[model samples]
Target: MIDAHIHLEQYDSEVSEQMLRELPSLGIEALIAVSMNLDSCIRTQKLATTYPRVVRSAYGFHPEQPLPQETELSNLLEWIEGQPREDFIAVGEIGLPYYSRAEALERGEAFDMEPYIQLLDQLLELAARLDKPVVLHAVYEDALIACDLLVKHNIQRAHFHWFKGPEEAIARMIKNGYYISFTPDILYETEIQELARRYPPELVMAETDGPWPFEGSFAGKITHPSMIRDVAAAWGALHDYNPGQAEEILTANTKRFYSL
Candidate 1:
């Protein structure tokens, strides 16, 4: 199994190292460590350098930050362009947030998304120029808008991780051949389960979105790559497949999507 999205930087170095060491035993073959800030991007790249086979990375500024001024945005773009592309797998963990609180927004706290929409457009241009896929993090109407940008840029390779869109947007995504990943949330999120049911198995994959476990079953718990098994199990139950078969299909889907 693969944990398609994780933040190794969120954990301390020693603890993150220990976790990586345990992943093989836990059935995680590879993990895509997503960066949420510039500093984390550097750290994520370093981690991937040290554990090349176990970890890969993605680079992008998260939407949580307020939109940078023009000068700052240009500096960020230059910095991203200067990074070693081979050290990363894609450009992602980028998109808008629909329900940010006022305080969060004031603190540059909540996800405003306007800046991210601009960022997405630039990232898509970058992806097209570099010929790489992107991992998107938006839900509902936001996801639809992101897909629209992808279409506009003709950037066909994209992964909409932990999707939470309405049926109409989901239909549009499927029509566009955009892939979606299901996290362990499937155990509790009927919406996620319905998404699993609506999409073809070949286009569907599983992720743990590690460091964040599902509620009820594992409240206040830290999730890991190994828990993808549980996600696969839930998906199997929803799709009426044997556990092994479901894992095989999802594993294949993930591999093909990430080109792992």
Candidate 2:
């Protein structure tokens, strides 16, 4: 099975090495290791270089953190542009900062939405130019704006990872034939399970977002790619598919979406 999205570079060196070494026997075929920033991209690139058969990299800034400075942004974009096409599978872990903005607002910290939107605009434009798929972080009302930008760029291949939104936004994504990945959260979150029920199965994929942690059955456990098998089980139960069938379906969908 392929992990559609994860931050493999975030884990400890020893843990990551052990995980990568044991992955094949655990039934994990590959991982789409996404970047959190330029440094993160470098680490992911190195990991991919070492595990050529098991890791595909995606280079882009994650929006939950502080926005990048002008030089930083330019450097990241230029670096991505300079890389060979096969170095990365997509431009991602990028989008509007909904959760971060909301947290700031609650803290009574004045927030600027325009700059984040502009940054996403720049990133999406880059993705379009590169002719690669996008892994979006947009959710809630932010997803609506993201949908608009995606259409503006005429980007046909996009993945909304760990997505949750209102009916309108979900419908918009579906209309565009965009894909969405379910994390291990689907095992315990009714909201996530309902999302699985609402979305077209063919457009669905399974992921663990590993090393980020989870709760319930996954509580206190270091997230791992193999956790996606449990995600497949839960999701398959919703669609009346057995465990093996679910894994096959999710693996196929991920391979097709990422052109693996």
Q: Which candidate number has the best lDDT?
A: 2
Clashes of 2: 0
Note the residue pairs that clash in candidate 1. Answer: 104-109, 104-110
Q: Which digits, one per residue and each the tens of the lDDT, describe model 1 over residues 38-82?
A: 777888888999999788888776665566678766776677788
In model 2, the runs with Cα more than 4 Å from the true position are: none
Residues forming the 10-long window of minimal summed lDDT in candidate 1: 95-104
Pairs that clash in candidate 2: none
TM-score of each: 0.91, 0.99
Over 138-246, each residue of candidate 2 has an lDDT whose tens digit, in order, gives: 9999999999999999998999999999999999999999999999999889999999999999999988888889999999999999999999999999999999999
Give me the overall lDDT of model 2. Answer: 0.94
